[model samples]
Target chain A: MENRKIPDNKIKIPIIPVFDPIEELNMYTSLGSLHTFIKGSKIISPGIPFYSIIYLISGQLEASIVSRTGEEKYLFEICKNCIGVAINPNDDHEFQITAVKDCIVYFFTLDMMVEILSQDANLLKKFILNIVQKVHYFEHQARDLYQCRSSSRVFSFLYDLCLTKGKRVNDHYELAVENISQKMIAKITGTHPVTVCKLFTYLSREGIIKKNKKVIKIYDLNKLCNLIADEELTY
Target chain B: MENRKIPDNKIKIPIIPVFDPIEELNMYTSLGSLHTFIKGSKIISPGIPFYSIIYLISGQLEASIVSRTGEEKYLFEICKNCIGVAINPNDDHEFQITAVKDCIVYFFTLDMMVEILSQDANLLKKFILNIVQKVHYFEHQARDLYQCRSSSRVFSFLYDLCLTKGKRVNDHYELAVENISQKMIAKITGTHPVTVCKLFTYLSREGIIKKNKKVIKIYDLNKLCNLIADEELTY
Candidate 1:
């Protein structure tokens, strides 16, 4: 994998980046603090002040998002010599990195990485290439990988959402107030995300759910309960 | 959506790039040549010496990879003001972009874009951000979109590959000499890509297909033929 010929992203199916790991290793070690986490420990989770460049030094890690209801959806794995790319940890929901095995992690501040990158144009280019490769890899996952969840199961998933947690409008009846997302539902319910998109469209047509940039409003809690009980929803 | 303050990729997505389209339009018009293609025309395809930055000024385009056997798998769509990102188009296989509607395209050479970017670092930064968003989008597609094709269907897909095209040894039966990919098969057959991956493992264990970086050897022609005929071959 160590090709000195300026390893490019290959811009295609070889999802893994092919830059010189040795050079990357050198760069990571140049200026970063090392932190060790034991197995089954939270490495980086929600509400933690983690603002740095994350590079795995040893052992294994897994990253995922935990819904407000505490349902965890798998994201990706990190092992030795891998970059743990967190897009924005401070999202509305929760994101976590867990140690699957005893691990050593290297954390570099953004300024330090910028300093290093600014110093070496080639390295900056390489870094850009690797990030492109990674971003490309994850985007594919979002597009596909959705399972076709039965409509009832989807309704049930909607009903059971406990985190934002899932809220109740009156007399213990449920209504979602927060902007719950389609991808999360897809991951959690194993339903084709198209279904979630369709659900939104259907809601618009039926005027069942009203959602916007910041808020979501669900109508007819009894109707949602009825669908769950019937367990045979078509759309 | 025209949200400035330097539109970010949103770290997680809502994948369509959100940079100010007006500013982007100005940049494209500044350095690009306007080329118009009538509807149902091939905008960009394999075997064309297209080494330039591509921006869609207007109209619609579809990008896909055509297998050697003449089978086309849909990749993504490009509408107005979209960046048609081609990673490394000079792969061993074919990639094409076709105009679904009448299109006006802006073609910018790398030097021109670089020159413009060199003038303003903000534009350069914005460009990088947009690229990261795009690369991230495609990667998700590769990961999760594969449907599960049955073993028989998978085998049939393997058998029917006509492009590299699929070659028949001894003028009677076929074996893939070139490295046929699982993603292409998944896209073609709607088979879960994991099944394709499993097929590779099964082949290695049975010593049926031997593959390396440069060479792939397939043994036993009649066995493959019989399996396809019976249509109940279980892996």
Candidate 2:
């Protein structure tokens, strides 16, 4: 997982929180705080105050928030070209995050955000723009799980990950499997691990992709996208 | 639905894109362009550039993105208090959005956002924060769908909604269901609308709550929370 390089044909999904480095350098250079959480570390728990938004440069992380009744916990999935938000860093908020492997996240606090937004409505507007896109993304995921078949969902998800964070190599597409797991994918895709395992096995067998544990190397990007598109199969 | 007053309990559900009035005033005082769409209007289509983040103060909206392939479309359910990202405003990305009712949305262009973020890192940070919380909320939903029982998921969803967005009256918590439909509840809970109907009927018959179309009045908030907490027999 750690050695996997982003594959070729991997579409670039750039959230680009700060698309312009010069602007970023001017505003957040002083306000931001940099903190590093090594692998196997718990960054925040339910009892602690909410922390800042941490940007992941490299490594993996996992976090869960318990249900309101505190009876069960829910985990976060999806990474690379993604940003993690823990809003209410005060009491009565639900947030629990842990590093899966050695990961680096930049914590951007609320106070600094307020200060920036206070001066620039354009900044606030940009911030709102990102939120709007994210809501749309999740809503789409929810719809796919119900309306599409499991195989459709799987291929769609893979294609999406490639688009979001994939990099183009010589011919193959290498997905950044930073902290993603089969179990997490199963949960998100509404399939059992065994089912996902079987599906993965099929993809590998068809020479569409190869998996070295968590990292998947796509040998045939066209085939994968085609499967996601399901040109031959009618939904 | 227009007459529905904001309930105190319902306010507990933080609108991830909400801007504090004072803070907002400190930033943007002038209202930007107000884009209007008739009922059943298509706001966005695939391959369209994502140029703005839209905030809906009133009216209903829907958005969907094709999963890489052009064959399938994923629809987004939206209402007031929703802020959406036009992720690829400059690229030939295709995602379609429609208005369910005559709607008015506030649009902040991508150029403006980039300009702001470049000038201020805090602006970028705030945007990241908004995405983080949103991702967290959806992650929680995904987790519940996978791990929790059907009944638990329904009850807990209702309970959490109440905690975040419901209004507390003398003895009951009032839920204003302007934007939430049985279909939406089903989609989020991963249940059928018929089941949600049955669950609601069962709860109303038991005198735990009273449903007036979209308005749900809970007679005992504590008990409702307990129902979710203890995983009591909900149906």
Number of the top DockQ candidate: 2
TM-score of each: 0.47, 0.65
* TM-score result, candidate 1: 0.47
Q: Residue-wise lDDT of candidate 2 within B1-235, one digit each (tens)? A: 5343222111133332232111221243133457888898878877755556666767877765565446444344566755565555445565677887999877765555455455555445545554554555555555555556666667777887887888988888899987677767775577778988887787788788988767989886676666654554746
Expressed as tens digits, the lDDT of each residue in B1-235 for candidate 1 is 5574323434443222222232554655767888999989886676553555668878877776554345465566677776664544443535678887999888876545655654554555556556644544443333223322256555544444422344556543344434345665555444668987787677667766566643445565455545544534566
Question: What lDDT score belongs to each candidate, Candidate 1 first?
Answer: 0.56, 0.60
Instruction: Estimate, for each residue in A118-181, the C-alpha lDDT of model 2 and write its tens digit.
Output: 5665545545544554454454555555456677777767776777767778888888675567
Candidate 1's residue-wise lDDT over A118-228, tens digit each?
555555555555665555444333322332224654565555453234466654434443434676566544466887778667655666666664455567555664665
| Cα TM-score of candidate 2 | 0.65
| Most TM-score-accurate candidate | 2
